[model samples]
Target: MSKKHKSEHHEEHADESWLIPYADLLTLLLALFIVLFAMSTTDSKKFEEMSKAFNIAFNSGSGVLDNTTIVTTGEQMSKERENNRQPSKEDLTKEQLQAAMKQEQEDLEKLKKQIDNYIKTAGLTTQLETKLNQSQLMITISDNALFPSGSAQIKPEARSLALTIATMLNKYPGYEIVVSGHTDNEPISTAEFESNWDLSSSRAIRFMDILLSSKKLDPKLFSAIGYGEYRPVDSNANALGRSKNRRVEVSIIRKFTDPDKSQNIPATPK
Candidate 1:
């Protein structure tokens, strides 16, 4: 009887051994649920990347999906549309060029009126000419009007010119001012300048200092450079051309946007 009872007890426990496989099935089902929950919560952009990687791992040539996941498409068909997207390298370079030109355009018109009025009032229009172009607003001051030959010093009368420009600049708050000095190709050897290069650069720096000296402006927004007859407005062949080239150029930093504000790079293009 004791042997038989022991045998029956052993048989009952033998059927219970299937619990191990049952527990394993439950574990696998729980893991599947967790994975599905994680997939549901992932970010769309990151999910797109992950999907692509998985597809590649599976050795599928076709991409995960066609334009199903993306950020934007760049197109500028109108002006009112806010271009608040990140621009591509080509788009960015082109935007910089366009902004530079457009910014110059508005500046030219305003500068024209202001300069014409000043010239008319102060009787210095012919001697001090304002020129407008695609990239710069140039106020040309004859040596007789602004400085002595080879000297960076601004004449007393030239103070009005600086003040007027500064006032105009104050009206437009977000522009960088670039003052560039150009010199005639003729060699300049003097105490003031080791060569035309020095003279040109010094003249640019000196004039820029006059602008930053204004308490209203920030020093960070101004730049000075010397072109030393390289970017002459006309041929070095004549006195008139050289005179035009020998003047100072004041450039207003144009606005529209930088690449950070206007460009959007999408991952699918790659």
Candidate 2:
């Protein structure tokens, strides 16, 4: 009877082996909680090392925290996005330059229209002409309008015209202005002038001086050039053509131009 009681007691202490795995599961849960707490306070490098150690001890590098990335600040994320999307410095400068060129072109067109209207209203179309080219807005005045034959002196009546032009020019500043003189092939040897070169040069200087008389016009921005019989628009063989060839030109030079467009006038004439 005692032996029968011992066998029953042994049977009553049944399935104690299952506690081993249950304890292991609880241990793993505790370890996972610990890993989460450490990750919250630690940097990415140390967290990665700890994660690796835990993974090796538990699941051979395939643990729950295997692919987690470090959290970043809002500023860092914004900077990354900006780096991906922002234009380069060169591209920004090119866009700005293109816009400036476009604005310059528009301003030149407006100025040309104003000068043209003035010329028409003053009945000076035959003696004055305005042309808008890629390089400049050129105002051409016949020599007979500004000067007498064989003379570099400006006509007294033309002083008012020059003053009006200078007033109009004062509307736009910081532009380089060139007053160029052209002459026919007629030879001139006067007391005040030596050759066509001297006559043309003096005429240009005289007209430029009138323009500079306006205090608003910058003297440094103005220049005078004389193309004596070398750059003629008409033939010296005829009276009308020679009259047309003798002229003075005022050019408001462009500060900016489109690179893709063709230049209508030489920027610097040889």
Candidate 3:
């Protein structure tokens, strides 16, 4: 009986039998993970094949990186460079034209003095006023000096102003010339003109005609405009303002200098 008890104790102390199946399950799980890891490390062709196969089997899109398509580094960089390109041909041309126009404005200061000197020497300072602006050398003549109060016919004395102006303008044949007419806010009614617009335009045309008929000037380089009472240099609320507004302006188209100019040179007549 004691020997039978010892056998039973030995059998009870033996390693538990459940360890066999538990070890087998662990081995199978480890093998499965290893296989999956191996599959994930495939080349492009194999990866595509697997992706398509999975998508078909699962009834879904390709099962790789969601919806992203991987691209080479060079290809990505080339695409980025293309997208960052600037200024089309037309845009560049427009920019160049605008730059040229702005350059012309810088040279107008000197041109004004030339006009002023002509005014002083020709004894036209009182009748033809000198004004310097960013883009024009305006020689303004009062209506009383150029014409009667309500007429476009220029006075005989006004010919001196036009003749000297034509001489100066002839020196710079490339400069564009504009004769513009301005007026006060007061209404006008005449046989030749019904409103300020007609009067202003007629005056501009008359002045342009005088300049064109000059033997020294180039008619091709001139034009005329009529800004009736709108573009005033000052408010039209007082007598001085009204008188200022009622004048004719002859503008010499400005020229450009170097972009780096720090000071103005004297207005030299060519």
Candidate 4:
């Protein structure tokens, strides 16, 4: 009976030892499954945090999660670099503004050249002049070209010249044209007109009417002004100087004048 009791006690001890190893195996399997789940997830940042927690709990600083944090940091840095490469709105707007200004300058230069060529070809250099200034493109016509002495009426032959000028001007739309008339410092008292102001004003209106007669010309873009004897380009002391002073001007205003250099008038004379 003593031998049987000792055998039972030994059997109990062996069973307890087997149960301890089984519990250890189950714990190892659970840890392995947790590591696999963390690796399969797409969030590298979260995986890195979880790995750090596990390292702290296990009192070990080495794991695969360290590599995951490096990858996450690299991705964030790459995104920042891409954002820096993008252009801002102010930069794009500045480039576009420069391009537009350049295009406008070219167009104005071309138009000025065309007018100059016409003036040279027509043998009207003495009776006509064109100037491109910062404020406007001015085409000056001698009073003898369009009117007689002490008269506001435009000559019959001058109508054809006005028509030709209108045709050329119609090619460039959206520009404001000011037809201004100036007289010499000679007082006029006639049955038709009272003073130089009335004569100059009447001449300007008549010329503008002829220019606006074209079907392609817009009347809204044209205006008439009379400077009378006030704005004289030359002294009215002699006949030659008076002739130069008595003139009609057609001015095409600039669309985009530079604000910084607005007062600087770049004169291209012809």
Candidate 5:
């Protein structure tokens, strides 16, 4: 009877062995839930560490989860901020730039017309000429109109002419005016000027000074240059050619434009 009781006890314990694996499965499920809950609350860096621990415990050196996209909360926030950094296009639209350019063109044309009319009325067309190009509107004046032979000083009779020109220039504000002087190939040496370069430069500066004497014009918008005899419009072989070469040029430059540059300017910062 004692031997029979031992056999029945051993058999009862054999079925109870299944409970060990069941308890292990329940523990694994609980760990999985805890890992998932932690991942939802923490950053990706911490989550990766926890995942490694769980994988080592449950998977026995194998991976329990597959590799996937793992962006941190901080990383996600940074990405969102970057997306919002683009400039707004409302303040500097393309239409606004085009309108501004059009207005500038109209102002330039009006100023040219006024100058042209003045030249015609004064009967100075023979001595003065105007040329318009992509870069500037140039008013060319013969040297004889403003000075005597080898003299850098403006003629006393030309004072009225200078005043008239200054008055006309005063009508246009905020424009860059360049006064450039050119001379004939004939060399000149006198008590005042030693060479053509000196003569031309002095003439340019003298003319510019007169133009800036008007209170309505800004001195900062004017500059003087001298080309001497190097930049001549005609050959120096004859009197007429030499006459055309000795001239003063007043140039009014276009505002903020380049014909070769792209017209589609970016309205806002990139």
Candidate 6:
């Protein structure tokens, strides 16, 4: 009877070890829900603290969630993507303008070199000069090189030189060309020209006409201006300085310029 009673008590309390592991599973599931709830909130500092505690409880600091990036909402992800997107149209246009300006500068430099080489080869260095600046490329020719003393007409021999210049200029089209004439302060009253202004104006017009003779050169892009004795490059008190003042300038104006560099250049009178 005593042995029978002991066997029944053992059967009644059989396999209680399974309940220990079941309780541990329930506790792990509850911890997982708590971690999920914390992540759903915007309190990052608390989430980090909770993550650390969980690491210590489950993985001893080395865990799958270690070094995890903070969870972000859909809108936040979209905003981040927009911030890292490609350049805008305005940015592309600015880059294109910079590239175009660089190309134009190179073209102008090459044209200047070619003209300089021609002047050297022709032994006309004293009568001709080329200068490239921020605004334009100026080719200056002495008045004596193209005309008789106090005359508006270009010499027959100078026609060939003008033709060559026109040929060179034809290689670079679509640029605004200004043919400006300047004279000494010496007063002039001739049968054909009433004043220095008349002479200078006629001279500029005649030279520009020759430049326009080239079919390849656009007449619409050319202009003639005469400053008379006003825009002298040197003092008019001496004969040599007066001679230097009598000249014609062919200026090829730039279409585009770098704003930063253009600001440093002094404004030259037209």
Query: TM-scores across all candidates?
Result: 0.54, 0.63, 0.54, 0.62, 0.61, 0.63
| Candidate 5 Cα misplacement greater than 4 A, ranges | 1-93, 261-270
Q: Decide which is better by lDDT, 3 or 6.
A: 6
Measured over all alpha carbons after superposition, the RMSD of each candidate to the real structure, in angstroms, is 15.1, 21.7, 21.3, 21.8, 19.6, 22.5
* lDDT of candidate 4 at residue 250, scale 0 to 100: 92
Backbone clash total, candidate 3: 0
Backbone clash pairs for candidate 5 read none
The runs of at least 3 residues in candidate 1 whose Cα sits more than 4 Å from the true structure, single-residue gaps closed, are 1-108, 257-270
Tens-digit lDDT string for candidate 1 (1-270): 999999988887545778766765554454344334436743454445444444442353333233232222112212223454444335547757566545545555676678778878998866777765433456666655667887888888787787787877777765667888888898878876889888888888877877777778877888899888687877788888777678887776444433544432221221
Identify the leading candidate in terms of lDDT: 6
Per-residue lDDT of candidate 5, residues 94-146 (tens digit): 77645655666666667777888988998988998887665677899999999
Residue-level lDDT tens digits of model 3 in 1-270: 999999988888867789866765554454344335436653445445444443442454333334233223225545755787754424446557457555444445555667788778877666677766544677888888888888899888777677767766776666778899999888998788899888888898887887877777877778888889888877889998888888888988665433445444334345
lDDT of 2 by residue, 14-115 (tens): 688998767657656655765685578434655665565556536642433343321233244446657877443255576786676677777777788888
Write candidate 4's Cα lDDT for 125-180 as tens digits. 88888887677888999999999898888999889879988988888887889999
User: Using alpha carbons, what is the TM-score of model 1?
Assistant: 0.54
**How much is 57 displaced in model 6, in angstroms?**
94
In the range 44-65, model 6's lDDT, one tens digit per residue, is: 7667765655555464433323
What C-alpha lDDT do the candidate models reach, one value each?
A: 0.65, 0.80, 0.69, 0.78, 0.76, 0.81
> Which scores better on TM-score, 4 or 6?
6
Report the number of clashing residue pairs per model: 6, 0, 0, 0, 0, 0
TM-score of 3: 0.54
For residue 78, give model 4's deviation from the true position in Å. 46
TM-score of 4: 0.62
After best superposition, candidate 3 residue 254: deviation in angstroms?
2.2
How far in Å is the alpha carbon of 230 misplaced in model 5? 0.9
* Poorest stretch of ten by lDDT in candidate 5: 62-71
Residue 86's C-alpha lDDT in candidate 4? 44
